[model samples]
Target: MPSSVTWGLLLLAGLCCLAPATLDEDAIQSASHKFMLNLADTAFSLYHQLVGPSNTTNIFFSPVSIATAFAMLSLGAEGTTRTELLEGLHLYWKEVPEAAIYTGLLNLLHTINEPDSEPWLITGNILFANLSVKFKDEFLKYVWELRHSDVFCLRFRDAKARSKVNDFIEMKIQEQDLDLFEEFDKDTTLVLVDYIVFEGLLEVKFEAETYVSEAFHVDKKTMKRIFMFRRSGQFELLHDEALSSWVLLQHYRGLGPTFLILPDAGKMQHLEAEVSQEHLTRIFHSMAARSASVYLPKVYISGTYDLKATLGGMGITKVFNDGAELSGISEGQPLKLSKALHEARLIIDEIVMDRSGARPSGKHRSNLLTVKFNRPFLVILMDKNFNIPLFLGKMVKPW
Candidate 1:
């Protein structure tokens, strides 16, 4: 179909960097680590935007996916547009120059996606341009050099285009639940689709048989029943006085701890206001190993965001407007980002991840050190080594 929209640069933002060759390995690693930290902070801020004071909304997203996607788009952006984009990503404040951030992101992504890395986690981007629009060879070359991925310019003849794309994603995710067709509009000429699949393996398993129906608090008065998975073992636990929330760290074999924060009754607002990067870092450092019987719901939560407004809020408005300078993408045509869509799905399964890594917790042992995520809770999946959040989630009710 003929459309005004054209091609897009939807590569992972940090997948490649416009880097100078003078830096040593140490410098690159340091820059990448700092970039990840800043990205984590952006994750928290974006989460806060989706979820307000109530903390009653369920949200799941790959902050890295969103950050890198924008980074890719920034390659084509110029003038104030590029500046605003970097600022939104907190790419400016990290002491490292913007080049370093991109360079570091390249290393960071490469390290995490090494061949030895487990299959449970996957993230990739595909930039699709309809056959009619001509993209710059230099742009594609730069993208290929950086992302090490191919961009396809296909003939969008029918719905099959959507089906083909969805099939690729489903195969990668190993699940067919999400439908990406709904996310795209007919006017979209150039599209960049990003996805993340994370199947977290628990270092210690919660027996599936122990799962029992329990009350999950949606609010003070509203409650719902959920098949809560029960386990009792040594876990890193903490009580944050600042947020008045009981923070529990459940370690996933190699993925790191999924921080489950359950706010005290009517304390959700306070938790939202007080939560920050420093606070979370301090909390992680202070957490001590304690034996407790923990309960968590099997949650299937997904978040779909139209990020134009969100990015605009962060001073990235010029790229979406008419005066956008995307000549870096296409020479003769003026490219405008008609839509910026992000979709993330997170499933906290009740069943043990795999046969080898985990064993069922035989039965629930009665103990004073007990914690139940029966209320609205926050789930932050982070990489302990990099201090980066892989998936940030809030489960108001798990079904």
Candidate 2:
């Protein structure tokens, strides 16, 4: 016979496999989409707050990964800590049951993990706890069922233990070569690590022969050289006078599409001020498909953020303090989140094809209008069906 802790972990893993299959497909998707949108809104709000007044630096992050970590942590919270976690995530627990939220998240993981899905998305979550402290069975069950996260019990003070945790994360996202954590504090009681790695090819790829090194304006006076990709096709375009930006939608092989927002001269700040869930949804719906010649630079952007201050700014203060009410995780031991670290990287490259085939006639190219991204712009990689933004950021400088 196994110990109660071992039995609990086994049950948790079993439940994860069974939960999504039992729920109604449509209801699960609907609730999952709503929850993800709410989380994305909160994540973007946090981004704007972190970037501050100086918006010159490039920014990139995985909001879905951050939100998923918090959702898992919320399961062990009690009283004020629980309330703050839920509200901070823009999730209303009263209207949505805890089971539903977990089930919905499971459904989303299933969709993205499908064998045939393009723009392959892979996510991993882990909870590292002190060896002396024992986690409650209920809390472990929720983490496993909701996020399919791996739970590890290790001595934080031990150097080998920290290396083991880092090794596991590296192996999970090895295709992208991401290292999520550099070191763990010896005094740390618990830490949550979440990451997302996405790689996709454009449905209509750029021709390598046409690739040109062009000038990318960092600002009015500064410029940098970058390889620009060109493609001529019908894309959904929106010229929003209110926001003073041009919205262009580009589809990958998968379900979600990436939206590029190029602000008119001197209007970047104005458009950033008006960003919100409602505003993004409105902009997406207002777009109409049109023929255009698009030129965008190939980019590889990566960022690491220590989110403790940002979470505090969003009214999630209690979880990081010593007196935090996390009784659900352990009754006798007082545990609070000591560190919240997030690191994300995105690689956008063209899928160069063989040019042996005949090219389009000259007449075909005459009707296409030109749209060039020579200045700074915002990119939103979102799931079209759910209005969920998997990744969001701005490219201010290529380097």
Identify the candidate with maximal lDDT. 2
Model 2, position 397, has a per-residue lDDT of 83
Model 2 weakest lDDT span, ten residues long: 1-10
lDDT of 2 by residue, 1-399 (tens): 333233234334654444454534456446655666577777677677667766678888877677767866766777788778768867655765444555555565666667777776677777778887788877777677666788788888887875787787777667434455667776788877777767757787655325667888878888888877766666788788878988887777775778788998889888888767677778777778887777777777766677787778788989988988887776577899877777677777764743755544468766667777878998888764556777888888876
Displacement of the residue 334 alpha carbon in candidate 2, Å: 1.1
- The per-residue C-alpha lDDT of model 2 at residue 129 equals 82
Clashing pairs in 2: none
lDDT of 2 at 237: 83
What's model 1's lDDT at 348? 56
TM-score to native of every candidate shown:
0.83, 0.83
What is the alpha-carbon lDDT for the whole of candidate 1? 0.69
